[model samples]
Target chain A: MPYDKIILGAGLYGLYAAQKCGAAGQRVLVLERDPGPFMRATYINQARVHMGYHYPRSYSTAIKSAHYFQRFCRDYGFCLHTQFDQIYATSAHFSWTNAAEFRHFCRAAGIRCDDVSPSRYFNPGMCDGAFLTTEYTYDAQVLKNWFLTELTKLPGVEILYSHRPDKIEAVGDVWRVTAGEITAEAPFLLNATYAGVNDIHAMLGLPSFQIKYEKCEMILCEVDERLKNVGITVMDGPFFSLMPFGQTGLHSLTSVTFTPHETSYDPVATFPCQQQSEGRCAPGNLFNCNECPAKPASAWPYMSQLARKYLKEEYRFRYKRSMFSMKPILKASEIDDSRPTVVRVMHRNPTLVSVLSGKINTVYDLDEVLQQ
Target chain B: MITNKEKNFVSAVVYLHNDGGRAVEFFRRVTAVLDQHFDQYELVAVDDACTDNTVDSLRSWAAGQAKPLTVLHMSLYQGLEPCMNAGLDAAIGDYVYEFDSTAMPYQPELIFEAYQTALRGNDIISVCPTHTSGSSRLFYRVFNANSHSAYQLRTDAFRLVTRRAINRVHASSENLPYRKAAYAASGLKMADLEFEGRMGDKGTGRLALAADSLALYTDAGYKVSAGVAIVMMVLALIELAYTLVIFCAGHPIEGWTTMMFVLTLGFAGVFAVLTIVVKYLSLLVDLTFKKQKYLVESIEKIQK
Candidate 1:
């Protein structure tokens, strides 16, 4: 029989949704543009499962995340890296939540919080208050494999690797999905394409979303000594982190506010939804996706300056490789980073469910979104 | 003899189910908290047919109290939903405080603050949870997201309700198997007093309880499943269109026509059967639990 649901994008949100639907006895098929999972934003971003420390301005957002942090641990504990204590220290400048307010929020949210002596942790002049949180990081590859294994165990679930959906049509009450020469039809269609959400919507002649993409880069560094798996984050401002990068001894140094390239909707303006924009690369209107640099441009030096300010032993951090990524964020979440997974069902056609993916820890939100 | 002052008294309803040693401490703490807040009040403790000495401990504590004490014992272990209904029926107070006996040593000050919040034109004052089981949190989100009713769900089991709100909850809960669901859907003006709840001593079948309550009150999962099935059947009609187009276009693949026909028909048949099964299953559950919605075996008043 034709699959009951066809989910586009095999990112964390898409894979998680497929597993949930398949378990519920719905025949599900997941299509990934990439050959495998975690080739895009899911792989390149800082893997910290936020626990209300990042968002001090939005209480509801902080509290909702508190639930996600615990839920992620309970559901996927084996895939998590808890080798080091994750600290949320407030920087001296451009900080949204100071030391005292952040501590109060942690207590109200029922998160375990402990104060760290400035002399003992971080550069003494870099931060005023340093506190420990229950947040942890997960290896993207391990998480991807875990989801894929669960999905394969289900009877009618199928994963189409490297299948790029080029067309989606609302044929009568069901959706007809066309990828390359292959065609599939399902009653419900969930567009969880993340950064490519607007791309599919544009192809289907649907209205555009208030979503934008930012070219982000993470500076991977090789530390002389292991940091005891402790992931460090300095608020949401221009700060750097020396966190355990998966199972490797190397750490991923990232900044929320700083990136190699300025955040843009499209580097090449022709295909706005494709996020491939070139700046005066050709004589005519011929656009090229390769015009944009695939690797980070001078991301290491900038990261090193911020790292030195925050860490006492900055000299131990050696540059490895910078990974370039596109961050898909809602226009609203750009301010406070608070919007969770939003399932926008086309009011005219309720059969098509478009899920704007949020935090990685909240992958379970797929169950709730599908139910809606 | 009930005096004019005691006639319109505040009532505190406590639920004790298999809670053994904590019952006496619970009674003492509840009464002490009540005395500091109200001039005239009564206690209505519902014992859900405990096998332990919880009833004896409660009875001994009631003998020493001057305020009115009523204990409603169920003939069977009717669970918290029905036990709450019985307590609500027996409580004759101007306002009512409903909380679990194992609710961590609730300071009288928070109770008074809740009362004051209610006095300031709020119909319902509830203590919201700072921490709860992950399943319980998911239940609230699912219920709220799918709920068409006006009442929004909260994670607070501890509540102080005015007489009007209490009446609304009682009236609305008469037909439902879940009391908290009914109360949330009762269309009452409610406000939450945020508090970090301590974990209870006993680990009840909370996951099962939450699932059962959600299925009874909000058929969110069932509705989504049925909707999905209906859409699938509709999609089968569209697949029929594709089959014809491909056939007329002289499809390259052999036996494609028969495969499409069987696939379309088979999915439609499965969905039709699945929808019917879910419908009847919901009815069966409702009919089975129809009698136990508010069943109370006996009630006894202990006073000097």
Candidate 2:
């Protein structure tokens, strides 16, 4: 049967789009490359719900995030973890934004930012200022379960796992995608694959986006009782962020310097590990980095040493494990240090729209394109 | 024959300042040597506010390599000492190599040789050329004569240091104005490796750095002030003795002249001693309150 919309990935964007379309009584088809949903970029990230506190250099990005922070909390309050205090501190050295600038940015963006004593949690002379902000983390597992249960009961939505389209062709105002023995056709095609956006475009014989890929690692740790209810992020420079990972008891530790193990400038993701992946991953098709055999060594020593340099000795943590994923960023955003969600209408006849965003709460940017 | 590479992680830090042409060649040679000798390594290039295209060219060249290359940009035109100190602080490895210049005058084998020397129980290893310029030799001679450190200064092309030495130097001072002087005074075991090559041209701000190092690390400044005070005291005693002899011999010397001379000499001697005391107190204040000396604009890691 023909469907109204066909979505490529089963991550948050794809799932949310499917739910929206299904609720509207439009037949929707979702194709997932992995066996499960939210198994890659959506689940293996620093799950902090952005309250516009992360971006101090770009005013638009911060204001947009603050605008969406409220809507996302109101919609998904069941899985939102708001029990911990989130602290954003500016480093005393090597920081682009000083204490005064950070405070000014927060005030202009109209977010909750209150100055606190830096010496309470950080080593003396390490940080210039610390602020207690209103931010929350979402439990990806609980969110994933909620999406699964809601989408499964919808009569108009159908999901296929472990499925990848090998051929995509345009046929008279409809897109026909085939993978092995199954084929699907839809008038509107949405590419919510994030890192695989270029790969999908290559299959359709369309122009590739000027983007770069980074194989990033997020280390999970077990924090002490003193830091269990606290989250700390040193901002506007090469610093680290340690925050709660979803509803899980573990904390996610990531550093701007040590988190990214390797980078590929090609539009399509390329790495040395692809040679030994045995067809599981390649430039045209990406497999999960967390389950790959040839992933780079853990950068625990570098990250831990960086955190210890700023935090006091009492705020202790032990390394649990590392989660790896592919991150793609627009090359133009490098100068302004802004992460703007880009929704490009590549094709008008078949209605091909590709969504690319870095932050989680910016998922609502898909609404305008989908409405069109 | 089978060759086994070392398993230790290494970080090589090089600073570039308006040397766009030489930086590419230097990076190529250094990366080749590091790749052949270690299982894992990283290159950290410090951009000392270059007014040329040095960083752009290096970034393009680094796009084809697989190992990680981090570029640290200084906010302003800070000199070699503070810029390299910032790069060294960013490095995370069991052993670190500090390349003083972008000119590779020596063979590539010298890099691994220095690493081997570091493994043989030395916390710091300085690689210098056998030949030195006349001015540098004179400066080192003067500096070593007054320096109380066990290790002597040299015209080093590059050096290798263990993590322990880095920690010790950081613990010894709040601001590292001169890395070589700090390492020499770190009280850690150190060795020197000499090669048979000519050194390149010296970098900018050398005279000012030389002056600052001598005043900060050597006892020459204090000694000069103390010597002047002693000379003033001796002159005051001589004048006192002369006044007593004149009064006893009845040479018709004016009473006002004798008293004025004695008072002037005595006050000058006391003020000279006070000058030395003030100098010592200021040095203590500087050591205790000075902040970090370097400011980095950003750190960018390029991996291809």
Candidate 3:
């Protein structure tokens, strides 16, 4: 059946966009490569609802995140977990931004940042400063269930799983998209397949963005009671972050040095693992990494050692398993460490909107384009 | 392809400084040796604020290799010791190799040989050249003579150490100004392998590092200060005795006894102040060595 909007990849952005379009009385069709929504980058991430503390160097991006942070918490309050204290720290060595600079940036961005004792969470002489900040994590499963229920109840919205567009062609004022035995046509097409944004653009004969791909690993572990009520992030350099993974009673341990097992600078996400995937994944058609057989070995040893170097001995964690995903980063934002949610109108007549963002709270950036 | 290769994770950390013309060649040789002998190995090249294209050359060469190559860029032109300390801190391996220079005068097989030596109950194995420069020989002689540690100093090209040695060294001190000294002082089993080749030139700021190490790991500085303090105190006592003898012999000059008494008091005060100053100086040294000392700008893993 023909629809007013066809959203590709049922991630947070795609699902949220579908809900908004449906609320505006527009018929929407959602295509998901995975069997369910939030199966890829959305669920396999740090799950940090950024409140501007992560980016002290980029003022604009931090300000924007601070602005959207409140709205996302209020809208998705059911899935948001805010019972624990989140701490941001600056490493004593190799840190780009010192404690003073981070505090100044926080004050300028109008965020709550109170000075806290570094010895409370970190080993002596490891971190220069620690601040208690206000940041929360979202339960991806709860959010996914909410989206599924809302979209199922809302009229004029259809979601098809395991459907990826094999072909996309602009015909007059509509996009004709086909995947295997399914075909759909829509006046507006949205490409919300983050890591696969360039791949989709290539298929549409549009210019690809200058981006790099990292095969990232987020390790889930069970933390001790001492660390159960806290989230810690060592910032501005190569450090580690240990935080609660939503409300699941587990912690996600990630390190800047060990999280990314491999990197690909190609226009599309390419890796040596694709050769061993046995048709399960490829550069053009990216597949799920968490289920891939050729995934890299767990970096738990390196990551845990790094965390232990900074964290106190009382606060401990045991590894459970690893969740893998592909992350795309804009080359331009590397200098200032800013993650900007980019929404580009690739074509005006057929209205092909390609949305690429690293942070989850920035999904609201799609409202301006989707409403127009 | 050899079916039997070492399965232990190895990390080779190479230090670079204005060696742009030679870094690619060095990396190629080292990686070839590592690949042939080890199943899992990573190369960590430390860019010590090189004023040349060393990092660029290494990065370009690393882009084609299958194994991972991580480049650690120092924020400033820190000398070799601190840069290598940072690199070692970043390395995660069961066994780590410290390559102090890019000039590999010996055969590549020697790299694996050092690892094998390290596996044979020796926590630290340093690969050195048979002949060393006259100045280095003299420096080692002086350092070993004054050093309280059992291990002797040598002119080594590279060294291989197990993870246990690294951990012990870290636990012993927060700042590793001189890694060779720290490893030697760690009291772990150490051996030296000598090859028939000439060693490369020392890294930048070698003299200052040499001085710092001597002051830190040896008792020469403390001995010299104590000797000075003792000689000054003895001279003050002798002068006071001479003044008393002159007064008793009826040949005392006007106000000479008073002058001698005041001089003796001054010397006693100076002796007490000197003792306190020495204590303060030692405390300062302790504080300096108990702080984090390296600053890295960034660490980048080259894409294969």
lDDT (C-alpha, whole model) for all candidates: 0.69, 0.87, 0.87
Writing each residue's lDDT as its tens digit, candidate 1 over A1-372 gives: 477888988878888888888888889888886777767767776777767677777778788888888888888887777767777787643455668877887788778889987545564434668887777777888888898789779988998887877677887767888887779988888888776676667666677677666656787777765355566777745466777776656688886544525444542212332332434222112212223443334445445645654565533678887776656677777567676677777534427778776578767666765764
- Name the docking class for model 3: incorrect
User: How does chain A of every candidate compare to the true chain A by TM-score?
Assistant: 0.89, 0.99, 0.99
* Model 1 per-residue lDDT at A307: 62
The number of clashing residue pairs in each candidate reads: 6, 0, 0
Of the two candidates 2 and 3, the one with more favorable TM-score, higher being better, is 3
Per-residue CA lDDT of model 2 for B1-304, tens digit only, reads 3559887878899988999789989999998999899877889999999999899999999988877788999889988988888888777667999997988778989999999998899999999999999889988998999999999989989999987787678656646778898899999989999899878866679987786687788987778777877887787778778777877888755556877876887787678767766766766676666554677777888866
Clashing pairs for predicted structure model 2, backbone only: none
- Tell me the deviation in Å of residue B256 in model 1: 99
- Docking quality of model 2: it rates as incorrect
Query: In model 3, which regions exceed 4 Å deviation?
Result: A83-87, A110-125, A130-132, A166-185, A222-230, A261-285, A289-320, B1-9, B18-39, B49-61, B75-77, B102-157, B160-173, B183-204, B244-298
True contacts kept of each: 0.00, 0.08, 0.04
Worst 10 residues of 2 chain A by lDDT: A119-128
Listed in order, each prediction's TM-score against the native is 0.51, 0.77, 0.82
lDDT of 1 by residue, B10-96 (tens): 778888898888877877777786776565677888888899998998788888787657788777876675677667655556678
Where does candidate 3 chain A have its weakest 10-residue lDDT segment? Answer: A119-128
